[model samples]
Each structure stands twice: as C-alpha cells, then as structure tokens.
Target: MSTTTSPSKHLLELQGVHTHIGAYHILHGVDLVVPRGELTLLLGRNGAGKTTTLRTIMGLWQASQGSLRFDGRDISRLHTPQIAGLNIAYVPENMGIFADLTVKENMLLAARQARTVAQIDEARLQWIFGLFPAVQKFWNHPAGKLSGGQKQMLAVSRAIVEPRQLLIIDEPSKGLAPVMINNMIDAFAQLKASGVTILLVEQNIHFAKRLGDSVAVMDNGRVVHAGRMAELAADEALQRSLLGLAL
Candidate 1:
C-alpha cells in the first residue's frame, strides 16, 4: 500500500544530508521528501535525529555534506534568517514563546510584515482565532502565565500569524491531554485545508495517523521508511517494525 510522489511535486527535498555537532554526527545521509499542500510526518524514537533533521532544514544547523532544496532551488548554505525569509516557519519543540510578552505581542513579532495588530489581516486573524480560541482568550495575557497546552497553541498561532509557504512544527501534541490533543488536531486540519505544506516532527502516533498524508520514519539519522499514512496506519506489523510500537 505504499505510495510515491514525484520529485517535481515535492516542495522540499533533502538528499544525502549529513550534520555534525562538534564531536557528534547527527544526520547520516538523510533523504526526505515533502509533497506540496500536504502534511508529512517525521516520526522516530527518541535520539533518532528527528529534531536534528528539522534544524538542518531550517539552517539552524549547517549540513556538512549533501544538498537541500526548497521549491527546486538549492538552499543548503543559507542562514537561518535567509531560510525563514523564503516563507518557511519553524516551531521548535521548546515552543519558543517569549515569556514576558503578551500573546498579542508574540503574534505581532512573528508577523514581520506587520508592525501593529491593526496591520494584520483581519480575516486571517479571525481564522486563527477560530483555529485556537485560547490565543484570542489570552491575547492580552503574558505568555508565561499560560498552561503548557495553551502555550503550545500560542506558539502555533504565532507561526501562522501571517501566511507562509511551509510550516515545520516539532511535536505540537507533546505533553497535551487527550482533549487538548483533539483541539490541536482540529487546528491542524483547518491549516491543511488552507493549502499550506507542513512538515511535522511528531512522536505521537495518534496525531500522525490522524493528520499525516505522507510519512517518513527515521532511525539513526536516515529515512528508513516512506509512504502514504493510511498504508502504515493499516499495517500493525509495519508500525511495530519501523516505529517499535503498534499504531
């Protein structure tokens, strides 16, 4: 039940990418593909280099070898700001919220094009509010005061504060309750409907199964499996073999 997507249709591609952090080599010739306008899940067990892969894509970590392409253009040597300027937004697992800033201020800061809340697109703001009501609820509250789940929502809200070509999020469902996870799922569903390509690093299989259109499972810094989400979701043995857990 595996599925394949043409390279031309892929918004992001990595071929033989390798990353080293001082004395440690993280990504070992990793190859990954993310199709346009679909959610692709990057799944792996702990210490499998999932976060390292994301950081490499963001130019937060320079690849020592291999090529990285976005929209068919070479971006392997770009700096973080340059990479971000290409309309790719990244939300790290730490959530990256400014604790002392108000929720509205955080959103405003992420919107580089907008200097004021009034400058933000009214309709888009409303859409984001619909996606995560907590953002709207805590608009004036300090981000540090929010609960874990609420802060995660704010982080996502900040990333989407303005439109972008791609959204790379690390574990949006991490540390969330079942009810909160459902809310996060719904928000992502709406985001997908908006036709934005997403690359998510998720350890939550339930979250991945529910929203992932394509999946690439990593181990020891390389992609060991790639296919349609439904295919992996339907095969319990494949799940166990690749992820070391049943879906």
Candidate 2:
C-alpha cells in the first residue's frame, strides 16, 4: 500500500463547508482537496451527502458556512455562471443533455464562446472524439435517441467542449454496463493525462479503484476518510469498515 502526507498542490479545496436545503441541513464541515492533475474520488453510500457536496461546489446549492477555493482564489459566494466562467465544468448524474437537440447542437450550447461548430477548436474536438467514439458516431443525431451510456458520454463531451481547468463529474459509471464503464474509465484516464484536475463522485468500486489518485469518503454529510486510493484499495478491512465492501 502507498500513502502520502498530503498533495503537493491543490487545485481545489473545501474547508468546513455546510449546506442547507430549506430547513434541513445536508453537509457538515466537509473538507476535500483536488490535487492538480489528479483524479480525486468522492465515495459514500446513498444519502451520504456526496451529491450535495458536488452541488455545493458548483454553486447549484449555496453553502451556509465555510470557504471554497479554486486555484488559490476564494469562491464561496459566487453564483453558478460566475463560478463556471472560472473555467470549471460540472456534469451532474442526470447527464444534463438537451434531449430535443442534435448532439452537435448540444456541444455548441456548452461552448459558451462559440456560436457555431466552426468556432470550436478543431484539435480539441478531435481529441474529444477520440475519447468518446459514441459521441462522434451520434454527432448529428437527436440526443434523445441515444442510449443511457451514450447520453452520459455526450454530457462529458459537452463539459469538455471548451478547455477547462477542472472537471467535476457525478457518477460517470452509474447504471452502465461493464463495457460502457470501461470506455468511460478510458476516457477519464486520457483526460487525466491531459493534466486537467478532476473531482468525481462515484459509487462503482471498480471504476473508482482504477482511476482514483486520491479518495475522500463521506458519511452523514462529512468526510470521514481521506488518503491515497491505492492504500484504501489494498486494505480490505479498511474498505469494509469505511465502504462496507472490499474493492
């Protein structure tokens, strides 16, 4: 098993974050760090506040307490658009695709600075196509016609339509077949190779074990464990104790 004291550099950091949805409190003093150029996995059982933490980071839900920092700048109170403008991309579990639109149109919509496909960087589009062949195959087709896995690919493609510093994705492998999950894992590996920081909320142990550089496990709205993924994967007892299953 491998271990480290801490990351050398953090691209994103959350300190004591708390969230409230109406009268109910969700997150409580949640602390997480996404190291530069590394994939950080956020894992927990159902209703563990994993999704709420992601939403809070994206400004979809306002944090009632604590500080959020991206690249050394404070962003605790920023709205969604302003936060997105900082070159961070988020893909929720729903995949957030426009069902009525063509895949090409959907990509165009995510490219905020581009009005047409021609305006998007050709090399970047080619790279995205390489990462997700399904996206390229269904480029001109209505998003609604694609299967669940295909829609997830389109969602990730849209998130990377423009170059981004950080990619925050929720459950990329959720409900996918083994083959589809492998494809998603490969795509994420390539994205990591390109040096984009990533924070992922994932339940699939295989997916997380294969791709995660660092891990944070949450329970009842707070982080309970933080360490190298390799260490967690190597220790079955730790896995069972924290995740209730061995990887």
lDDT of 2 by residue, 1-247 (tens): 9986653499999999999999999999999999999999999989999999999999999999999999888899999999999999999999999999999999999999899899999899999999899889999999999999999999999999898999999999988999999999999999999989999999999999899999999999999999999999999999999989888
In model 2, what are the clashing residue pairs, if there are any? none
* TM-score on alpha carbons, each prediction: 0.96, 0.96
Tens digit of lDDT per residue, candidate 1, span 1-247? 9999655799999999999999999999999999999999999899999999999999999999999999988999999999999999999999999999999999999989899999999899999999999999999999999999999999999998889999999999999999999999999998999999999999888898899999999999899999999999999999999988898
* Location of the lowest summed lDDT over 10 successive residues in candidate 1: 2-11
- As a whole number from 0 to 100, the lDDT of residue 188 in candidate 1 is 94
Question: lDDT for model 1, on a 0 to 1 scale?
Answer: 0.95
Q: How many backbone clashes does candidate 1 have?
A: 0
